[model samples]
Target: MATWQCVKQCGACCHLDPAYRPDLDEYLSPEEMELYLSMVGEGGWCVNFDRTTRECRIYPYRPRFCRVEAEVFEDMYGICPEELNDFAIECCQEQIEGVYGDRSLEMLRFNQAVGYIYKEG
Candidate 1:
């Protein structure tokens, strides 16, 4: 089975465009919503994301909404621990595909890291 793992230098999740996530209020609390919006910078990328480095500047202290922990996923999306792997993988797949093309290098790296095998259709 495939496991979910974040790929290095793949900051696709940092593309925090509110336009694509219209249901932000549904999942995040009021404070989180505000913080989430505040993090959105030019081109909808996270303000803390260093484009050149492809890394989060505030990674160590990033908001709860930015974490991929089981508890955080449970609270935000009602995802149980046993389901976290697939759920996180799916979320990453969609986000990465949206931020970058499905065939982009980021997607390739993410799939390999997660042990996800796919074929072009």
Candidate 2:
């Protein structure tokens, strides 16, 4: 695994996901999703992101998406060939396929079906 460090409370990374994804309810309980929703605000930003003070409201309660490197390592197949293995554990198609088989492929298909990607013309 590669090493990483958070640059204080920049909140820049949080902008990636924007709002508390509704799809989270599928994986997490309704109560947990509610807690996350409580922290979401305008511009789809986490409610914990304070625009005035430029800080986090509940850093302790913040979700794992806020800490992505670790999440990617644990949740995903631990592979991102394009990034030179910076954001996640690097693994070739052969290596990953041996371990994850179709599980990761199913997840990718699900994300694609659920509009996990954004695009514009």
Candidate 3:
């Protein structure tokens, strides 16, 4: 059977400036923002991203954009096919499933409600 994995904690997705996202910060509650802020740092990368290692510190709590499907990644991020791993990256599939396992509906609703859905920038 196949498994899933991400880009080894690559911070590419988190590199975007939250400066343009005051609406983003306001999208969540103060408590949620505080908890999330405790994890973001320089480069607007998630605080979990260790600059030296170029990896996410809090992989487990990473948001949906980080959990993107491989095809969606290439299509949405313009990553070439050769630059990505296969459909399921195997190594951490179980870990991802553990988090998003049976929460498909919840995830969809929450993301939609908060405007976390994708759009071309």
What is the TM-score of each predicted model, taking all chains together?
Answer: 0.96, 0.42, 0.37
Clashes of each: 0, 1, 4
Superposition TM-score, candidate 2 onto the true structure: 0.42
List the lowest-lDDT window of 10 residues for candidate 3.
87-96
- Tens-digit per-residue lDDT, 1-121, candidate 3: 2222334433444554456345645344566566556656665566666778867776786754456555655654555665554332421232333334424543343334434433468
Residue by residue across 1-121, what tens digits does model 2's lDDT show? 3333343433444442323233555545567566666655666666667767757777786666444454444553344444533442212222233433534663344334333442358
Q: By TM-score, who's the top model here?
A: 1
Per-model CA lDDT versus the true structure: 0.92, 0.46, 0.49
Q: Give the TM-score of candidate 3.
A: 0.37
* Candidate 3 ranges with C-alpha deviation above 4 Å: 1-5, 61-121
Q: What is the lDDT of residue 83 in candidate 2?
A: 55
Q: Model 1 — TM-score against the truth?
A: 0.96
List ranges where model 1 is wrong by over 4 Å. Answer: 119-121
> Cα miss at 69, model 3 (Å)?
9.2
Residue 5, candidate 3: C-alpha displacement in angstroms: 7.9
- Model 2 misplaced regions, further than 4 Å: 1-3, 16-38, 68-72, 76-85, 88-121
